[model samples]
Target: MFGGTDDAVIGFSGTGGQSLRQQFVANYAAKTPYLGLLGLSRSPTTISLPDGYSRSFSSTLAGAWYQGAQGYPASLTFGGYDALRGNTDSVLTLPLGAEITRDIVVQITAIGISSVGDPATPVQNVAAFIDSVVPEMWLPQEVCKVFKDAFDLEWNDDLGLYLVSDSQHEELLSQNATVSLSLESQGSTVTIDLPYEAFYQPITYPLADILDGTVLHYFPLRIAANDTQYMLGSVFLQEAYLAVDYHRREFYLSQAQFPGNENEYRIVTVHPPGWSHGLSTGAIVGIAVGAFALVVIACGLLWWFKYRPRSKKRASRLSAKSTEQDRDVFGYYGREKDGGEETYEKRELDTAEPGMRGSIASRCELPSPPLPQYSPGSPERDWPKDRGSIDMVEMGDYLTARRVPVQSPVELSADSEHERRPPPVEIA
Candidate 1:
């Protein structure tokens, strides 16, 4: 429970291994802490807890060590975890509300009947807390009275809530107005804007076996004592994110992101004493695979580009050599048949012109017959110099035969002398 209405102070003491127990719990997701303000000196009374090892408390948040007088501090020294809410964005900083101050105030800016937008009002400072246990806002009677006339709200004593008729609800939603809070600290003030839909609370009832479909649309604001300041409560926190640092004496608040919004999530881990930091197993594996894939792709591209030019140069050289050989042989080139036998193409030569015979025989390296000359006044044909013609001939039987060696007749000894001999012929 919050100490917004009256003065409340509690303390404990023990000695010789016997200690008093206290607890401090923090919910980072909800942005609230139980027993967070215990040691923070509140208004009308100062907050304290047991400090000795024998008389101490257990806590999830990091605790601070006090080095001063037994009860209160002459020169108070605090640490970061005294009211720590964990690390958050610095742009979310909000000014301190009137909690320990004498006046119970929850000042905020809202639209007036004669105003076009959020207008300045006399009630600009109100005491409020981002409470998790409560579901709605609880305001002082004076502030509620003003909202009643502005929103055209009807108070239902049976339901103990301010209800809006269907027509009024439509009119309020159509205005598209917002309630904003201004928190001041140092020399700057941060404003938090809450949309009108943040306060639409619907309630249902079940009568016997049947159900009454009466929907109670409300703004989630309750009337409290005049001295009691406003409570911002969970209704305000549902759409807001908050961070508090007691050691620095500062808090931060910003509008929360919706579920569908894209965001980068970075986990903030709190390390107790003796804990070390290192990379996780999954993260290490991901890095190794990514590096390997990049290396493989780069090597493949380099190899292909290096060999492409060399292949093209080799093909061009072979093509040029083939063209030269074809011209020297008079278009007669060997074409391999099956069983390794070579075949050649034959072309017939015509002897109608005088110069055609010499050109064809010279290019094919063959003997040429005599050509007839053209008579006077006859038309001469202009033949291209680069082209030549050759006559096909049967050369199988004209080819030279291979030579064979013969052995000479040998004379024997005395018995072989009887062999007859022929006389030599006289030269004429």
Candidate 2:
């Protein structure tokens, strides 16, 4: 009879209660040394509710069995898996075998000791079933021999196990060998690496029948008589994670992570196809906050571009109007002439016609004292051609006699007669 939590019992009720029977056999035979079995099958148990409604229990099973002092605590998850217990990125998913006799069968392509400096044992299309009911791995005789030679293990005929002596255990520990098992199914391959510590299972009491109270550390490996007996038992699970989806007949295998005391529990739910379990409160709130933030940003942008202050635009328009008023009808940049406006003292050339070039010199001439005449060979007449105009030097001496500051000289060329006119002066 199946007895446990209602959910556990109900989950196995549909799968023929085979899990309970297996547990019974394992417990009686002492096959499972650590903990009892927990079935994670796809079977659904239907029960009638008080309101004449029926409910069915169906969920996925995911777990990891970690042993030894350095291993993490064992974890068994229903309806989901612990994300922290396995490397989710390296998980290998494969469909379950079609045979009714086999449940979680996979093809083990190769097995080797990575640190032993020896070639891998070629398994070659060997099908093996994974079970947690038994504690040791039942591999082919050739593979067992290879493992024995590599690990220096001794086969005990009385115990029917590969036992390791103290010296052998110490040597193996110092070597720190890692056993790699390559599994393939449905064209997908995954290799799981197990440290030497994973196989060093201690045998004691009823399991070993040791009367002297000596704990014998043995390598958990058995020789299979035929291919049909090939099995990777609980020892393999110590380093491999397993998840079963009975509804879809699919299973997954991944390298188990052992973080010891630093490990955290992170459960991720595995939902069935077409099943909907509405979003959590946290998720809903997060989405709502994100949507609200987007709306706020959009509104802020709309206000900035469409509804913000138009002071800059108004200022631009006013400046444009002022500019238009300042321009004459010809579009020249000057203020419009008005009556009674104070007119500035201007040179005679300011009123001259544009084409009246010949009259420019006479119009700009002021009634000043005449300059002293100089001989052809005199210093004044032969002054450097690079110097400023002669008129400017005489003006400077004149200004100095009157105690006025001399202004900067303006160079004038004889070829540019039209450019010699004085600038218009403003009246006081």
Candidate 3:
């Protein structure tokens, strides 16, 4: 009743990706050696006969009805309900052409019902036993499609062994126990999906995760559903890369999975001249360390200049005191003439020690004082002895070089970064 009536025309529509045969044949032809798919009957109407192999229901020929026409119904008008499977009568296969289109065509048949029951209106209900019968299921298609779509393999006539992707299977698909139609690229496989309840066969996912491969588009299925009676249902076939010798009617099958790139794997390569890779982390630390070293060196120089001068204080105390007195006595900082006639003249002080200058001036001066002259032998008559002062330049071998003038420590300036230098004193 869902498909309408058993005898009524049941129209179905669906879509799918490129047919496996077209894809397989195209790949094999790509090599320099030329080949393609073995063309079967372009369209199959009935499995009853191979185009012209039909004969009446011969006793020995009933096998051909199921095997030839029924089992191999690649193309037909409509499909029949497999009473056993309990699944809707929808069979699918690869469609012609490369561009993905849907609802191209499918197989269906005429069903029958009888309208022979009499209708009687009852005012009082009469006791009657009613027995309803459920349809029997011969559901081979359910078991066939559900398990067959997991993978595709082919025996290589040239290699004589089945080459399959064992690692990829054990990883993403097998562990998850999930299945979808996956198309292959060079080294990776991507899944295709669509919207709507009919397409929601296995599971559900967001629109973002489904836009991967050329396979499993919705347009073809939309086209497949345009029929009034016949509708090609969705098919489940992994990409099958096959090989065919076009000249020979018998085409060979191989794991076309390689071409579709279903179950693909990715391998990243990092090649030669990788020398700079290890240095990146060290380079960052090196910059930080270099900055710290500069700070330490600058701080050390500042400490030495500011504090080193304290060590030379004792040696030059008298010399420094004499210079200060000379400046004040003949200075202009606080002195001025009140009267119009000047009473004093200004003179410059020679930066020399009193010990040497006094000795030289006394040597040439006339001395007439003779009162109480003590004999040289008497210790009480001797003048107070003077020790000659040491010249700073000649005191020690270590101090021979001219020392850098001590500068004040560089603190954070008012502007944060600008360091100001103090003015040097005039030495004249």
Candidate 4:
């Protein structure tokens, strides 16, 4: 049989059944949470029981099991689990409080093994590996001898394994034989005791070589021929919870617990190192939207400033040019007597005629005879032959006299008292 996680288990049956019929069986069980973190790193690893309770992984480091150069068993802290409260069997705990090292080495010293009623002794320092995939303990051939002698077991040369009678198996179960390990921590010694049940297993043989009329039974134990390595497999793990901390280079082993309810749980946040707080998706989206809106607003304001009309500037420039025209060409300072309000308003150029300034200067220098004032329906009088154009400002009493009524358009001389003076120009 091979079993660890439900996802990876295979079982086989051999020659023991009636008619020697062969069959293969497979099954799946609940999804084990710890199995999901296998071969993965930097994940929020956790494991929970049937109850709602859960325990999160304790570090920011990734949990990679059985797939790296530094593979370790999933172990809990040694004293983290509660004690076995109601069990009748005597259990032992050996605390291996070695300082954490870079390499997460999980080793326990197996001192010795014995059968029913035999006094357990300490073997030399024996290293063992904790592997859950292994069905049972794998002991060295020499260490297997100790168990064989203590139980008075027979060895079969053909099978190269120990053979236990049905009576011996029953007696061993009644006596509850044990194996021992010695751990040294801080100059003090701790011992771990394993009962006979921890090593019990059922073995099967192939059906191809069954003899006629011969009955065959299953044997569980197997010995390592080279005596070089010993393994503590799932049998031990079923009774213990192992937690490994790669960052701290340490591990803990405690007796497993089955909480009836999920109320009791410790939530741990396991994130990558240097990770504290980060912006959420909503916050990032909000900031992006705000930035885009601001950009659009800025572009609108820039376009308005660049292309909008400048009516005030055009008005000011036209007023300044009108004042310049009044000072340079017409030079008019006419007085008005209407409604007790004295007003002087400069008009813009009606026509842009060249040499008009010289003609006005010549007409102002000499006085001519006064012309007759005509009524609305009077016959037309003969006009003077010298000046061909009329002064639009002085036509029909439109331009008020400067405190004097002139008879003709040419009556206003350069030295005449009736000449109008230019109005004052307002700067700015």
On TM-score, the candidate that comes out on top is: 2
Task: Count residue pairs with overlapping backbones in model 2.
Answer: 0
Candidate 4, 1-428: lDDT as tens digits? 23333322211123122232243323434333233212222234344468754333222221122223332222222223323311213333233334221122234544555554445554554455555545555666666667678766777777655667778777878877766655443344445555665555444322324435444333334686443446665666544555544443344454444333212334333344555587889999999999999999998887678644465677789999897676556644565666899654433432333324354332222232234334343222333333232332354423421222223434446788776744332221
**Model 2: per-residue Cα lDDT at residue 276:** 65
Instruction: Please give the range of 10 consecutive residues that has the lowest summed lDDT in model 4.
Output: 8-17
lDDT of 2 by residue, 1-103 (tens): 2333322342223433323232222113443343433444545433335774233333223223234333344567788888888789887898888765567
Q: Give the worst 10-residue stretch by lDDT in candidate 2.
A: 396-405
Question: Which lDDT tens digits does candidate 1 get at residues 127-230?
Answer: 56555445677776777777677778899887678888888888777887566655544555555556666667766553112256777677688886553545
In model 1, which regions exceed 4 Å deviation?
1-118, 206-211, 226-229, 246-249, 262-264, 267-428
What is the lDDT of every predicted structure here?
0.49, 0.69, 0.28, 0.46
The clash count of every prediction, one per candidate, is 10, 0, 35, 14
Better of 1 and 4 by TM-score: 1
Q: Against the hidden true structure, what lDDT does model 4 obtain? A: 0.46
For candidate 3, give the lDDT of residue 350.
32
lDDT of 4 at 328: 56
